[model samples]
Target: MALLNKYVGITTSDGQSHDGFIAHVDQDYITLAIPTNEMYGQMNGMPAREATYRQFGFFPGFFPRRRFFPRRIPFGAVTGLFLLPFFI
Candidate 1:
């Protein structure tokens, strides 16, 4: 999947609206990195933040499915029939 760089508006636990750039995403979470002002004493702590799985929206597309490989061949005897002709 492609990494996206976009602004997202999120409502915090305190019922505040925060807008920030999305830094990374996973199956269950998103990381938002917000820039701080120089006047805020250099913003000592981490700038990036995280949100829950349900906070974001998705665009319409197909999701990938698990790959399955057949374990048993119905006719093991016929396998040689299909390959033997190629060798001859």
Candidate 2:
């Protein structure tokens, strides 16, 4: 769709707003690539040691590194979608 690959803010039916890049859009859902810092703030406690290590590349992987956490939002729950001016 028009929003694919763009940074965006999404407001869901529950009134929660999520900011991320629109990675994929299909008939049923939109997948957003949420920043790691944003995902950390949403979590309940400090990240586990292993998770931190993985995030910071203490361990190696064959695939390319990922900087975002992928989240799929249902189309029916999306109330608003707009561009977000994010500075990295």
* TM-scores for candidates 1 onward, in order: 0.35, 0.65
lDDT of 2: 0.77
TM-score, prediction 1: 0.35
Candidate 1 lDDT at 4 equals 46
Report the lDDT tens digits of candidate 1 across residue range 1-88: 2434454455544444444555666665555555443243232332233332123321112222223221211222121211111111
Instruction: Give lDDT per model, in order.
Output: 0.36, 0.77
**Quality of model 1 by C-alpha lDDT:** 0.36
The root-mean-square deviation over C-alpha atoms between each candidate and the true structure, in angstroms, is 25.3, 7.3
